[model samples]
Target: MQRPAFDPTAEEVARRVLADIRKHGDKAVQKYTKEFNGINLPPAKFAVPREERLAASASMDLLFKRTASEIFARVVRFGKASMRKDWSMATPKGGVLGEKFTPLARVGAYIPGGAAPLASTALMSVALAKIAGVPEIVACTPCDKKGQVNPYLLHALEVAGATEVYRIGGIQAIGAMAYGTAHIGKVQKIVGPGGPYVTAAKKLVYGDVDLDMVAGPSEIAVLADETAVPAHIAADLISQLEHGTGHEKALFVTPYMSLANKVLAEMERQIASLSRCESITKAAASGALFVVTDNLDTGMEVINRFAPEHFEIMTKEPRRWLQKVKNAGAVFVGAWTPESAGDFVAGPSHVLPTGGTAAFFSGLTVDSFRKRSSVIAFTRADLIETLPLIEEMGRVEGLDGHARAARIRFENPS
Candidate 1:
């Protein structure tokens, strides 16, 4: 009825590629890498050499280093503050019950390299894994025809603490990361964003490896009132369109038709000068939505139904209306805040859920790279007191073995 709830073409292709990789392993990965990226890389040269990572880091200028350092500080600070610690409480029976956070032993971060090299995404995704203390952080990005990744992206991956780097992208990268290959070992989890094909591949490989969310093409929505500036709203709407994928979406919902007309005029005036105007124009024409609601409250309801990845509140007293938001990956409050700020320097990871998935999924965070295990230490008193409850529940659930195990422990308390 709804095209199987995902892109049929994307899933069909991804299923074939993933099954190939699951069976053929490295050969299948190489085949798709050549077909998609147009580069034939042998398994021997699949990895980015350590020396290359160093060279990319050294090539960066002082200004770039300083900027990266500042951004990294913010990301690390937020990660540290948000990370949960091992905490416990004394139970009534003098037993210890708590949760211990354990970082995944290995995780893969997929960086998009097709449209534009997402250097910021390297920090947004991989740096958080580093903060979570993941022992082995693997990064995979597509290489150009010359078999080289963007220096900035490579450098950022190194700064973010990726232990292993691969020159592969698309379904192949997800396959290699999810299913172990001779070239790249399997990772316990896969994180980050990509295009439609990549997004579909991630969904297909869910049980094989843990995933962050359904993060695909960029999306943004703005809720505005009479007080908002047309120029700012137009610029913000166009920002998500320039992401190169035709799947990118932008929405502007406001109470004033006059503002809607003005924003559209501004977009027409501003888009001509952008470097990626050709793709942006095509994407905007097909994906952009401009709605004039009856009031600000109605405008909020429209954008919430859209469930955008980046939601902007540009109305008067933006913070006061923030409480009304029900679905959004991230919110940019007030006029001075732009989506680009969150894309680059903001403390939170920009790898957010897209394509209306914000209704169910959340953006990535430091804890996405870790596992939480609840601890239970039962004293004799606790076991004895809870034993009856366990036995009764087990019997009701048709599991006498569970009841016997606890009863046996007490029965043979030698």
Candidate 2:
């Protein structure tokens, strides 16, 4: 089936919110925050106090704090490993050409706190930015009706090295970071995942600020055969469904008809016991797909077309099948490696491209926080030797000024 198009109403709402924020700054942001989130606050209350950040950190459960620390360490190691180094090469003309990688000056991380306080997101975006050597990392998240941010989220942001924290959410938070309100400073780029409104806001502000990706709902595709366990497949599908937005997608593709039927039965059985059974049921009805292909090759084709955010290979030869995957934001090699491992503490950022964007965009990485620039250093002889080529190309393009610039350098050569 073809994917559904984005909601026009959400886009229009986001456009209006962004325009208002751009025109009125802090006043507009406060108005929208109260309207959308039901939390009214003055401009001074926009930022979370430093003492609250520390208190949150101190109040965290000991076990939870330890796990978070371990995940942070793993993510940091992965970020450092994924970072690219600068290198230069000597050209045939004795010129030097290379790419210099530099971390962004200031960046904003949007942690989703509407449905749930995504403390892991603070670790994912903020920690990765810190690992990339970013000097300033700012975070924005929604608060409860009481105008209080979640303690776990506050702790996570502080632990991940956020330089600033804001108690704002939705499109207004995005606009405040992108356009810079009286209370919050503008960031060079914005990174994180959000609901439809947030994604639409990011789309509207693309040129104004750099974005990681237009991430939408969560999605997962599982490719399995007879060797795969029905229970595992069913549980994996239900896991993403429990993310509680009915927009989440879960697909199970297989060559064995019996396996497909068994997995479906298992899903029905397992979902009954889940706390979010209603959400799972709604998501399964709208977004789940079960395909029994002619063979493994056809199953693979279906998965590639979907290009899910998370792909799991549960075939007899899972490693061999991995070589054929070209799309997916992240891949799980075997039944032992579930998508949840990558979602939490697998050392890679769980903020992945969704809504089939994995076909073009990539998952979050340390490099996402850095920008690269091409450096060219040419000697006088190198410029003279390349002058004829430059002049000829410039003349062919119908530009006399471009050709004269190259010729002038030679005319006065000492």
Q: Against the hidden true structure, what lDDT does model 2 obtain?
A: 0.90
lDDT of 1 at 160: 85
TM-score against truth, every candidate: 0.97, 0.97
The models' CA-based lDDT, in order, is 0.91, 0.90
> How close is each model in CA RMSD to the real structure?
1.8, 1.4
TM-score of 2: 0.97
How accurate locally is residue 50 in candidate 2, as Cα lDDT from 0 to 100? Answer: 95
What is the per-residue lDDT of model 2 for residues 286-324, given as tens digits with 9 covering 90 to 100?
988999999988898899989888999998999999989
